[model samples]
Target: MVAITGSSSYNPIITINTTTTINEKLTPATFPQWRAQFEALLIGYDLIDFVTSKHQCLAIDGTKSATSKAVNFYWIRQDKLILHAILVSISTTITSFLTSCKTSHEAWAALTCLYKGKYRTRTMQLKEDLTLSTRSSRSVIEFLQAMKIIAYELAIIDHPISDDDLILYILNGLGPEFRDIAAPIRAKETSLKFEEIHDLLVGHENYIRRMENQLASNLITTVNYSHWKGGISSNDRSFSNMGHRHNKQAIHPKATPSSIQMNLQQIVQPPHKEKIKNGLLTLLHRTR
Candidate 1:
């Protein structure tokens, strides 16, 4: 492998061409994903040695022939190409890790040591984050996605969280509103997948929202109905009271309709006429 890489005829373009565009750059949280992509790219180009420290740069010495200088030049070029690829894949914030590394092997070594050796610390932190996560005002999907990301981080560190434990963590964080479903999930004898639980929680969330809307609608309807009924009752009471007062005044004996009509007749008829009429009726009776 060293002889082949050191040959003047060997091209480094093969390694450059094999470079897969890493969509997700390296970050503390994404180390595992970044490393997998980078490693695969190196492996595909048969240039894994450049990063693995397997390919040593040919020595350029005063005693060496012109052929040796050609080998050294090509070797250095390939190594630098690999190193540049690594630098570009990493995020700017974390470039400090490779600041002192001059070659591909050094850069790769620095990153591996920093991430793999320090996994324990990151793993513990992620576990804590997962444990303390809550649904809060976020939707069920958002909440679950956050927890799942933590789980994935833990898995990358080889400290995978079991489904049961993960479910328990999720239930604990969902607050009392989801206790109905959470309790049932806890008591189940069969194991459930994360996807299944996610669906169930989302469905329950929708149901809760629907119920709240229904309750609000019902309350508004009840308030409007009561207000209408109260207005009608108030108007009816006012009219009834007014009619009762008028009837009471009109029916009093001193102010009755019959008394008014009799008074009117007494004023209109003359006293002499009534006496003359009565006398004539008596005389007629005597003749008969």
Candidate 2:
């Protein structure tokens, strides 16, 4: 839990090392590899080591949130930190939440799929970072990103991020019956009285209504990610020039070419996690 500070031209950098405690917390019935990766991402880099300026930033990731006790270490970097302030689908992870992050409204059309619309407030999340800038430093893009971040991370509610047609499906599937449910009403706190029952009923109804909407929305998300799996974005122009939108339709029935490479860094690869498991097993076997 020790924090060390560093500085850069753009911002201040904070570093923390939680290896000792995190190693103790590692468990068998969990995503140990992901947890270890998170631990490394945290201790491996300086939490805060840059300037408190604009051009550059130095930040660290958090566990669920500053307050949440669950050691769900999050993946955060300067780029992801910017997700709610100024980002676009094409720009970077942070900017993707805002409308103005892209070059044109057309670009926004694609990025807009990430928006979570709870009727009045489209942001499915929120954020509180006093160090980055004043809350007053709000813009359409920043506003949206902040809102969605809060909603998804804090509320366990996510803004729908499917295609336009999927959005239309969500609206249609909601069937206008759930439209007037009034998010404020659902958000209101109820005591242990019958009011709680009433609120619960209302919540259940809304959830039931959302079932259809969610199903359709999920399909689009899957399709999008499926496309991404085939390698969607890359910096090399030559890669970009190869083709946009890896054609799912073009693959012949005869055979599937290309081994379908994956990011070895993520998912399957868990650093030396396997090695650790083997080492532990060896110790147990020798004792036996």
Candidate 3:
């Protein structure tokens, strides 16, 4: 453990335990997420100033005075503590990168340059991702989230995306389903925030689902009505057939013996010439 007092008025004296507090080890692969934690730990112990060379003691004169010796001792002790803390916070692989460095400041610079390259490479990748992003295969929510992540990464690398640009990207990448939502947003006098746009998209999605459900219900109802009408038409034809059969039975009365004899007499009998003359004479007398 080492106690270091900060020269800055706002920073208080801090005690750092190299064994416990510096347990988070960093490597080339894990440097991005681990950098913040390591830097915060250094700041907490008030030793970051030493690593940045902000707290170096002034060079003493060649005289062997007690005050000069004391100043040299204090400077050496503070520098050693900061260097040791940095060493303990990284893995052996990362330590190899700093082996030639003799001071904490040198090691800090080396690490910053190494990670800056990684950061630049990451920044380019995020830019490409943002450029190639589309909503064709993913939901609107998923597309928006991916764009936001890319924007955040770009901002981290000192290349922040503007709100207007973000909105345009969202609109351009969206599927045709979102055109209605995009139209109104684009027509607005002022641009909507990302949150506002998200809400509007969600609302539109719900509306589309409701419309689809209503259309499906209507189609089902139409099919059922047609089926019912067809059944009624079949029943009407059956009733008409029954009525025709009933009328035929009413006229014939099941062919009793009297009705059979009448039908045979009409078919077999022929009228005589005298009978015809008598029928004509009877009609003339009636007219007179």
Model number with the top TM-score: 3
Local accuracy of candidate 3 as per-residue lDDT tens digits, 102-185: 788888889988888777778778777777779887777887898987887677556788888888888888868888888888
The positional error of residue 224 in candidate 3, measured at the CA in angstroms, is: 3.7
Q: lDDT tens digits, residues 141-205, model 2? A: 34334433433343233223323222222223333344554344335554233233335435656
Candidate 3: deviation at residue 3, Å?
A: 8.8
Ranking by TM-score: 3, 1, 2
Off by over 4 Å in 3: 1-25, 40-48, 60-79, 189-191, 231-288
TM-score of 3: 0.61
Give me the displacement of residue 286 in model 1, in angstroms: 79
The candidate that wins on lDDT is 1
- Report model 1's TM-score to 2 decimal places: 0.57
Candidate order, lDDT descending: 1, 3, 2
Which candidate would rank higher by lDDT, 1 or 2? 1
Comparing 1 and 3 by TM-score, which wins?
3
lDDT of 1 by residue, 1-288 (tens): 112333355453443532345767888878887887777777866889888888888787887877778778888888887788788777899898788998999999898888897787887888889878999999999999999988987776678899999999999999999989998899999989999999999999999877866654443343234434454344434433443343433112233334433432342245433543343344334334
How far out, in Å, is residue 253 in model 2? Answer: 41
lDDT of each: 0.71, 0.33, 0.65
TM-score of 2: 0.15
Worst 10 residues of 2 by lDDT: 259-268
Q: In model 1, which regions exceed 4 Å deviation?
A: 1-13, 17-20, 24-33, 40-84, 91-106, 231-288
